[model samples]
Target: MLTIQFLCPLPNGLHARPAWELKEQCSQWQSEVTFINHRQNAKADAKSSLALIGTG
Candidate 1:
């Protein structure tokens, strides 16, 4: 498993469009991916649309 922190470069942060694109990119990777918002104590599957949305 590889942990990656995806910083939101957009002013709006990881909105719908970018989030979907991120999921697509993550899905292409061979390793498992997961995203965690340390501040919010939130976690999500980096490859799932629903989970990606939860990151926002």
Candidate 2:
């Protein structure tokens, strides 16, 4: 499994467009991936757009 933390300084945080793009990229990889937001205590599947948005 591989995990990464991406800190976004953008005012919008991780919105639809960015989340979709990230999900698309993650989908192409073979490894298992997850994103966890320490501040929010939220978790997201790196390959899923809906899950990413739900994390926010």
Candidate 3:
């Protein structure tokens, strides 16, 4: 598994609009994508809208 750390450049962070965009972007990837918020110690499936919202 490849683990990458990226800083969110979003001004308002990952809100609904951006999350949906991310969901679309993740669809293009063949590999499984997951987002981990270490600060909150929470994780979410990058393909899941509900899951991503939980991280917010």
Candidate 4:
């Protein structure tokens, strides 16, 4: 597994549009992807926009 950590660049943080876009992009990959919000102690499946949004 590959792990990447970066700060969110959005002024409002991860919202619906970006989360949906992210989910779309991740769908092209066969590997499982995860999004983690260290500050919030939240984890989300990258293929699910709702899960990504909840990570905020």
Best candidate, TM-score-wise?
4
Tens digits of per-residue lDDT for model 3 on 1-56? 88888888765458888788888888789999998866677899999877877786
Q: Which number leads on lDDT?
A: 4
For all candidates in order, the CA lDDT equals: 0.73, 0.79, 0.82, 0.88
Flag regions of model 2 displaced more than 4 Å: 1-3
Better of 1 and 3 by TM-score: 3
Query: lDDT for model 2, on a 0 to 1 scale?
Result: 0.79
Query: TM-score of every model?
Result: 0.71, 0.81, 0.78, 0.86
Q: Candidate 2: worst 10 consecutive residues by lDDT?
A: 1-10
Identify the runs in model 4 with alpha carbons over 4 angstroms from their true place: none
Global CA lDDT of candidate 4, please?
Answer: 0.88
lDDT tens digits, residues 1-56, model 1?
44456565555446777778878988998887887766557778888878867765
- Estimate the overall C-alpha local distance difference test score of candidate 3: 0.82
Put down candidate 4 lDDT per residue, 4-42, tens digits, no spaces.
Answer: 787888755589999999999999999999998877889
Model 1 regions lying over 4 Å from their true place: 9-13
* Candidate 3 residue runs with Cα over 4 Å from true position: 10-12
